[model samples]
Target: MKEGIHPNYRDVLFVDLSNGFKFVTRSCVATKETGKAEDGRELPLFKLETSSESHPFYTGQQKSVDTLGGRVEKFRNKFAAFKK
Candidate 1:
């Protein structure tokens, strides 16, 4: 690969803020902070609100969203005439 035209790629510590879970992976994202990984390696810190580990869909905790007055209802109502 060419040099000086690409962002610096290195290991980064991705942390799930909801559960404090952490994992290390290579990334080119920038950060002004640093954190230590499980193996004691200092890496750039990146925070995540939801990862596969903590996501509702992946955790088997997802809920149905077909609620009253929701967008689904609005769509169905608006398109009701077109259905016939």
Candidate 2:
């Protein structure tokens, strides 16, 4: 491993806007804002729309798919008539 040329890896806070969930993890991502975490540790605060806590997959929430009017399916159905 080389030194001085690599990005600094430090603690970063990922805050989910929807659920107000905050978590600290080590990352190379830089941010201007900083705040003390729930554990009383100072970390960079980064705002995000979705995180593992509020994401549909991780939260086990049923997501509604808008496949009924997909353009690809419509095109395939339209071309299916010519296949016969």
Candidate 3:
């Protein structure tokens, strides 16, 4: 590994907006915000809409609609006119 040729990889804080869950881990993701951890250490902050903590799939709260009339049909109907 060479110096100065790789993106800055360091610890970053990820916050889940839905549940306000926060965690810090190593990452190279870019952010314009900063936040402090529970220990009072500041780290680059990245906001997220869904994470394993709040995701329906992981939480077992997911609802399944009949594919015949659900998103698949809605999407096909929405763009069907483009086929002509």
Candidate 4:
């Protein structure tokens, strides 16, 4: 609550590049770009690589990794000398 020592907080526009999703929220981050919202209001524009709109977990599109195979292969390699 100190005066003249806090960063400016205002509405900022965050754009998800993957799905072209845009939203406005209050933040203290700095930006040089601006974007217009659905209501025709201009605000600071920030770009993001991933967001809930296109994230695999949020969208229920998670991919399964072959971690079990990797662990089995590593175990076999580590104990191969003992078996010989």
Cα-based TM-score, every candidate? 0.73, 0.72, 0.72, 0.83
lDDT, candidates in the order shown? 0.92, 0.89, 0.94, 0.94
lDDT of 4 by residue, 11-68 (tens): 9999999999998999998899999988899999999999999999999999989999
| Candidate 4, run of 10 with poorest lDDT | 1-10
The TM-score of predicted model 3 comes to 0.72
Across residues 1-84, which tens digit of lDDT does each residue of candidate 3 receive? 888998888999999999999999999998999999887999999999999999999999999878777888899999999999
- Model 4 clash pairs are none
lDDT of 1 at 18: 96
Quality of model 2 by C-alpha lDDT: 0.89
User: When superposed on Cα atoms, how far off is each prediction in RMSD?
Assistant: 4.4, 3.2, 5.9, 1.8
Task: Report the Cα lDDT for residue 63, model 2.
Answer: 86
Model 1: residues with Cα > 4 Å off, grouped in runs = 1-3, 67-84
Candidate 1 residues 1-84, lDDT tens each?
A: 787898778999999999999999999998888999999998899999999999999999999876766987899999999999
